[model samples]
Target: MITLDARKEKVGDLLRVSFQTQIKFFLSNTKTKAAKSVIYNYIDIFTKDVEIINLMKEYEAQTNKKLAITLPSEEVPSRDAWVNSSIIFDSRT
Candidate 1:
């Protein structure tokens, strides 16, 4: 039987690989700017989630490698925008 920590580690690795693959597929196959924008927004939301951030951090620490999702330069949001948006939503609840 697999231990709990080992399972978690495996899941993390899968998550990272799956995310990378999805991004590559979308970038290559997506044809319209509007559709790509929507997809990028969803990706931003997923990557910015607190739980996902923590998981990525833990994975990086374990593997000694960086796992980052890069978007097109034009589609990338500023750091301040991310922080402010999170604060706005966090304050609402």
Candidate 2:
């Protein structure tokens, strides 16, 4: 359920875009003091997982570009890092 609004690209007719997708914190740890504010009001931080696509096409032709980005973990939060890398082990049911 991700929606990207591309209304900011007024660059070349050969379209270009830069985007960094983010995961917002809503309904946070309601049982913990640490996330009180995040639970009360919607909270958000940025992440680079958001995929951006750019295409350059003549009005009736197909065109494309490779959209590769870097998501260095040191630059993102580690709070829930385990959720993304718990695939290597078949232990602990």
Q: Top model by lDDT, which number?
A: 1
Candidate topping TM-score: 1
Write model 1 residue lDDT over 1-93, tens digit each, in one string: 887455654654565456545544543564334334433454564345444455445445544656546756666553334333452248676
Candidate 1 residues lying further than 4 Å off, grouped into runs, are 31-93
How far is 40's C-alpha from truth in model 1 (Å)? 6.7
Segments in model 2 whose C-alpha atoms lie over 4 Å from true places? 1-45, 50-63, 78-93
lDDT of every predicted structure (CA atoms): 0.48, 0.24
Worst 10 residues of 2 by lDDT: 51-60
Backbone clashes for every candidate come to: 0, 0
